[model samples]
Target: MDDFYSKQSPFNPDVKSFRFYKNGNLKIELKTKEDAEKVARLLLP
Candidate 1:
């Protein structure tokens, strides 16, 4: 298998950029280019 272990620097947070969500039951929107997909997959949903 290809080694796909990610590096810390490769997933650095965007200080000026961030995802936003109102409440737990509300809608959530993420920065388009911030690799939000990876983060989203980590959610319980």
Candidate 2:
């Protein structure tokens, strides 16, 4: 998942940072909530 995010990050300038929780959840921080939502849509099916 980290590698996937790294590869995809270049196409998403709005992404500020991303982390994977110990519980297996992904947390992505973006410039704005809308950007976060957009990233979520792209990352998810």
Candidate 3:
């Protein structure tokens, strides 16, 4: 998990990323409609 966050450079300015919650919730600040679709797919049961 640390390695993944490191790869994303969380300290960098304005980096788009998704956060997977422990309760299967995905948290992200979507910047485009395409991003929303991608997340929706992953969340589908």
Best by lDDT: 2
Task: Rank all candidate structures by their lDDT, best first, as comma-separated numbers.
Answer: 2, 3, 1
lDDT by candidate, in order shown: 0.40, 0.65, 0.54
Candidate 2 segments exceeding 4 Å error: 1-11, 40-45
Write candidate 1's Cα lDDT for 1-22 as tens digits.
3233321222344322333233
Q: List candidate 3 segments past 4 Å from native.
A: 1-28
Model 2 global lDDT (CA atoms, 0 to 1): 0.65
Order of the predicted models by TM-score, top scorer first = 2, 3, 1
Candidate 3 local lDDT, 2-40, one digit each (tens) = 222222223433336656555556556566777668768
Deviation of model 2 at 21, angstroms: 0.9
Please write out the lDDT profile of model 2 over residues 1-45, one tens digit for every residue. 443333124336787766656666676678889987876798799
Candidate with top TM-score is 2
Please count the clashing residue pairs in each candidate, in the order shown: 0, 0, 0
Question: Candidate 1, which segments miss by more than 4 Å at Cα?
Answer: 1-24
